[model samples]
Structure formats: C-alpha cells, structure tokens
Target: MKLNSPSRIHMGLIDLNGELGRVDGGVGVALDYPNFQIEGKESSEIEIDFRIEIDEKDKENLESRIKNAAKNVLDIIGETGISLKVNDAILSHSGLGSGTQVSLSTGKITSLVYGIDLNAETLAKITGRGGTSGIGVAAFETGGFIVDGGHTFGEGKDKIDFRPSSASKDVKPSPVLFRHDFDWDIVLTIPKGEQVCGDREVDIFRKFCPVPTEDVQKICRLVLMKMMPAVIEKDFDSFGKVVNELQNLGFKRAEVGLQKESLKGLLSKLQEVSYSGISSFGPTIYSLGDKDTITEISNEFFDKFGIEGEIISTKANNSGYEIIK
Candidate 1:
C-alpha cells in the first residue's frame, strides 16, 4: 500500500492559561505541498528506505522515527515484517508537522500491512503522538482549516500542566471543534536555522504558560468571531488580519519572541506585504496572499539578509491524505 499525508501549519495555541478547564487548543491549516509519501509492503523483517535526497543527519533521524513507529505498531499487531520506502520527505522540525506526519504515516503503514485498521487518533496513541496539540493529527485525518477544543486540564485530567506534544505523551488528541474548506493561496518560507525542540520546548511551555487570560480570550474571540467566518466566507482579508494579529496575541507572542533575529526580520518583512505568521515552533513562516507578491517579498528578504531556505507556493488541501492499495 502507498500512502500520502498532507503537512500542516500550526497557526497558534489557544487557552494556554487553562483557567477554563482546558489547555492547548489550536488553530491550523493543512497544505498540499511538502507532504510525506511512502509505500509499505508485508515483508519478513522491519525495513525502511528513503528514495528522496537527504543529508545523512536528516536521513538518520528520519529512519529512527520510522523505525520507532513501525516497531510500536508491530508489537501491537503481534505481526512481523513491513518494508517501507519513503518516496518523499517533509523537513523535520521546521514547523511543518513533520514529526507527527512521519510517525502517523509509519504507524498507519505498519498497521495496514498486518490488516489492522486504525484511525489517526488511535495510531497517534499507539505511536505516542498528539499529546499536546491536535492540529497535526487532525491535518493528517481531514485537511483544510481546523480548530481543536483542546485537552482537559487540572489534577488527574488529560493534563495537569502546560507542555509540548513530545513531552505530553499518553494524552489523547484534543477534540476538533470546527473544520472548513480553506482555498486561499499560501506562501511557505522555511528559513534555515536551529529548530526549537526537546528541553527548550518544554522550558518555553513551563516558563510562559498560563499565558495572560486576556490574550487567550482575544485569541478565542478572533478564532470564533473573525477567523472561522472569514474562512467559511472566503474573506481573505479578514482571515489574513486574524493571521497577522495572532502573532502578538497569546502563546504565539512568546513563540515569535524566541525566534532568531533573521527569522524575526523575515516575518516582519512578509507581514508588511501580506498576512503572515510563524508556524508552531517555527523556522517555517507562512503568508497568505497573492502567491506572486508573497514570493517576490520572500525572495527579496532572502537576498537582502543572505538567508538560506526554501519557498513553496501552495494551496490548502481540503481532502486530507490519499492511499493507494
């Protein structure tokens, strides 16, 4: 079986304050490009191959993720033997939901090889994903614009404190509150830099969380009253306004504050020309606007700053992943 999964932009985390009995609510969009495509077959032993060009460091990390996920699924199914060939790759830790996409794709492929059916959430649980944010998991299951209601908070609840997905293992994915078709042109900029993860990510969550309640309220209001309506109505301007405003609102503000000077400058440059913001713990900045204008602005910014990265002009993937048997 061959499977392809869409990559996603984690617009922002909402309600990190967790005063309202929930935490880590999220808003995001799924993209059509920078996806993962892999083919899996029943085999005598677990094996993984990458057909795409990638450096040794990235290849080793990618292989580890795939092997770990496959092993987890193999244990569950009481079966052996799955061979996976990665035909395409998503850059890891670039704020493109690459880890979740890679893990879920690996788990899904492994389960299918043994004829064990599972949804993304179940696969997520088995693979130890979707603990903090559901945006990535939701994007894999059903693409387009998505909002998740977040996990229950407090002692003995889904979580007791603020943490990133990698640290919040065993917690289930948050509930998706709203989903709608998003057909806007998007320009994705993946600037080369140190990506935040592991202890640093956990420290950020620990330090700034329970973000200001007012900011959380503002984000909720924007998502509910402005952003959702804008997407449903295809009001690019309204949606773009929310996108730009989110950068300074709540946890997003902190995320942006931690970016390197170069990345921060690039985001500022893009926002001047289009509605732009960082995606998750990013180096991947996304802008919503005329593809040509955003592309030109990004190129100019790169040229001026001598930054190295990739620019992808793509659209929302409303239909999610596809599988060919």
Candidate 2:
C-alpha cells in the first residue's frame, strides 16, 4: 500500500531558548511546502519514503530518531503488531521544519495503515516531536499560519508537571490570518554546516538566564499583546520588528555558544537588506519579503557567500493538509 503526506516550512518569529525553564518563548509561523509522500504498507511490515536535505552529520541521527518516533506512534495507538522500515530525508533544514514534518508524516501513515482514531493533538503527543515548538506539529496536523500556546516550564522537582497532562485533548490552534490572501515570500539561508542544540547547550544556557519573575512575565505579555496580534493583521513591518527585537533580547540573555556564528552573520546580512526575521535555534535564517525583493536578495546572498542552499517561495496555507486519493 502507498500513502502520501504534506510537508511545511516553519516561519521563525520567536526563539526557543526559554521554552522549558530556560528564558522566553519561541514564536514561529508555519508555511506549507509541496513535499511529502509515504508509500508501501502491510500488516506485518511497512516501508516509509520521504525526501529532505540537511547537513550530512545529522542524517544518521535523524534517521534513527524518526524510526523511534514512528515506533512510539504505533505503540501509543496500540498497533504494536506492525514493523516499520522508515526511509526519510531532510530537504531543507534551517527554515523548514523538516524533522517534525518527517515524524508527523510517519505517524499519519501509521494511523492510516493501522485503522486508528487518533486526533491531531493526540498524534502530536504520541510522536513526542512537537512539544518544544508546536508550530511544526501544527503544520503537520493542520498546515497554515499557526500560533502555538507554547509549553510550560518548571524547576527540578516540578519537572513532572511540565509534561502534557492530557495528550488526547484537542488543541484548537489559532489561525494567524483568517482570509489567507496575504502576499508574502520567504528566502531561507542555511549555512553549509551542522549546528546542534543538545542537552548540554540547553543546560548551560538555562544556568545563565536571569531568574527574576518580572522578566518572564514581561516576555509573555509582549508575545500575547504585540507579536501575536501583528501576525494576525498581516502587518509584515510590525511583525518583523517585534520578532527581531524579541530574538535579539533573548539572545542577549542566552549563553555565547547557544547560536551558531554563520547563522548570526547571515541574519545580519538579511536584516541589512530588510527581510523579515531569522530562525531561532541554529543556522537556518528565514527572510520574508515580496517576491521580487526576495529573489533579488537571495541571488545576492548566494553569490556573495558562494554556498549551495535552497530557495523556496510559498504563501500561508490556511486550508491545512488535505487527503488527495
């Protein structure tokens, strides 16, 4: 049997440095991409196929991670009888949510093959893929401009409370735009290298972050009041400014090695040319501008850097993913 799934790009609005007792929140938008397909299914065994390009170092770990995630999905849905052969790749990493997309596609295929009644939120939890940044899971479950409520954080003893209490509960994600007629284009610049945000980095950054209660409250207020509303209105200028400011502030509080150097340089250049905002974690820099501007800027950046990267332009997918059989 063969199955098909949809893929998406994540618009980096906020950084994820402060998600779980760290510093602030990571805000992002989900851009729908025309990539995703799952083929071959059987009662005893299944084969998964997907195409995505990322840094070579992450390839091995990514493959294993996805396979485990797929197995987790099957186990959570009570379909442990099936064995999976997952063949996955990352087409674009820095800007697109390739990792999350792969897990979602895998989970969706497993549900279809096994006859499971898992909803979007339930599936997201089962996969254990999109809790830190829910935008990726939102895009996989429902493609479009999604504003996730973000995860809660706690101290050492309170860590257990942070886990999702009800995995099966439906989370109605807010749509950034209602009509979906916004004219926008994104140019993703991923430096040719591997940038890892592992457990060590997270711990180091968390240790350095300020512990004042007022600071966290202020960041939350800005996210709810200023950032979210601007995105809903499709005001690119205000949105870009607020997002950049938020990331810059968070970066200051973060440790020195949290973000990669190449990503920082690319972001500097993109900001000079007036794109939108940069990616949160590592080397993926997303520049948002009109078609003409995006094209011209992308060409100039590629020519100057002399590196091979992907440049894709797409609109907000308000309609989400559809089954085309």
Candidate 3:
C-alpha cells in the first residue's frame, strides 16, 4: 500500500493556562504541498528505505520514527514483518508538524499491511503521539481548518503540566471542536534558522507557560469570533487579520519571540504583504493571501537578508491522506 498524507501548519496552541481546567488546545490548517509519502509491503522482517535523497541526519531521524511506529504496530498485532520506503517527506522540526505526519503515516501503512484497520488517532495513541495538540493528527485524518478542544488539566487528568508533544506521550489526542474547509492561498517560508527541539523545547514550555490568562482569553475570542466565522464564510480578509493577530497572542507570542532577529524581520516583511506568522515554533512561517505577491515578497526578503530558505505556495488539503493499493 502507498499512502500520501498532508502536512499541517500549527497556527498556535490555545489555553496553555490550566486555570480553566483544560489546556493545550490548538488551531491549524492542512496543506496540500510538502507531504509525507510512503509505500509499505509485507516482508520477512522489518525494513525501511528512502526513495528521495535526504541528509544523513534527517534520514536517521525518519528511520527512527518509522521503525518505532512499525514496532508499535507489530507489538500490538503480533505481526512482525513489513518493508517501508519513504518516497517523499517534509523537513523535520521546520514547524510543519512533520513528526506526527511521519509517525502516523508509518503506523497506518504498517497496520494496513497486517490487515488491521486503525484511524490516525488510534495509531497516534498506539505510537505515542498527539499528546499536546491534535492539529497534526486531525490534519492527517480529515484535513481542513481544525480546532482541538485540548486535554483536561490539573492532577489526575489528561495533563497536569505544560509540555511539548514529545514530553506528553501517554495522553490521547484532544477532541476536535470544529472543522471547515479553508479556501485561502497559503505561503510557507522556511528560512535557515535554529530548529528548537529536545531539552530546549521542553524548557521553553516550562519557562513560558502557563501563559497569561488575558492572552489566552484574547486568542480564544479571536479564534471563536473571527477565525471560525471567517473560515465558514470563506472570508479571507477576516481570516487573514486573525492569522496576523495570533502571532502576538498567548503561547504563540512566546514561540515567535524566540526566533532570530532575521526571521523576525522576514516575518515582518511578509506581513506587510499579507497575514503572516510562524507555523509552530520557529523557522517555518506561513502567510495567507495572493500566492504571487507573497512568493515574491518571500524571495525578496531572502535575497535582501542573505538567508537560505524554502518557499512553497499552496492551498488547503480538505481531504487529508490518500491510500492506493
């Protein structure tokens, strides 16, 4: 079986403040470009290969995620052999939610090879993903603009502390509160910058959260009042305004504040043309508006700043992943 899954832009996490009894809510959209593509077949033993050329470090990371996911499925189903190959992949830690896409894709293919059916959320739990935000998992499942309800907070609940997904593995995916087809042009600008991960990412969550209650409330109001309505009505103007506003609110503000000055400048330049914000952590910035204008501005920014980066102009993937036999 061959599978193609969409990559997602994690706009921001909402409600990092646990005072309301729930935390880690998220909002994001699924993109059609920069996808995860893999092919799997039953084998005598587990094996993984890559069709596309990738750096050794990236290759190792992809292999580790694929192997771990396959092992999880094997251990659960008492089935042990599958050969998987990565035909395509998105950059890791580029804030594109590539990790979740990689894991879920591998798990889904392994499950199918063993004749076991599993949805993305089930595969995520089994493979230990979707702990902090459901945006990536939901993007893989349904593909659209998605809002996750987050986890119950406090002692003896889904989560008691603020942590990234890698640190909160046992928690299941948060429930999706709303989903709608997002029909706006999206531009992804991934500049060469610090890719925050491992201990640093965890520490950031600890240090900067729980975010201020006022900021979380502002984000909630923006998402509920402006963003949701814009998505449903296909009002690009309102949606773009909210996207721009989110960069300076709640946990997202902290995430953006950590970026290098060059990246910050780049984001500011893009925003002058359209609504722009960093996707998840740092590096991969997304903008919504006319693709030509955004792409042009991105190139100009890179040229003027002497920064190496990638820019992809794409749109929403409302249908999620596709499977082929």
Backbone clashes under 3 angstroms, per model: 0, 8, 0
Best by lDDT: 3
Give the TM-score (vs. native) of candidate 3.
0.98
TM-scores vs. true structure, each candidate:
0.98, 0.73, 0.98
Segments in model 1 whose C-alpha atoms lie over 4 Å from true places: none
Model 3 lowest lDDT segment of ten: 185-194
Q: Residue 169: error of model 3 in Å?
A: 0.7
lDDT value for model 2:
0.52
lDDT of 3 by residue, 168-268 (tens): 88999999999999888788988876799889999999999999999999999999999999988888889889989999999999999999887888789
lDDT per model vs. reference: 0.91, 0.52, 0.91
- The residue-by-residue lDDT of candidate 1 on 1-325, one tens digit each, is 9999999999999889988898998999999998999899998898888899998988999999899999889888897779999999899889999999999999988888778888999989988899988988999999989999999999989999999999988999999999998988888988887889889999999999889999998999999999999988888899999999999989999999999887888799888889999999898999987788888878887888888878999888898888888
Off by over 4 Å in 3: none
Q: Model 2 over residues 171-193: C-alpha lDDT tens digits?
A: 22222222223345555555565
Compared with the true structure, model 1 gives a TM-score of: 0.98
User: Between which residue pairs do clashes occur in model 2?
Assistant: 14-27, 18-23, 18-24, 52-89, 52-90, 52-91, 53-90, 53-91
Q: Positional deviation of 11 in candidate 2, in angstroms?
A: 6.0
CA error at residue 270 for candidate 3, angstroms:
1.2
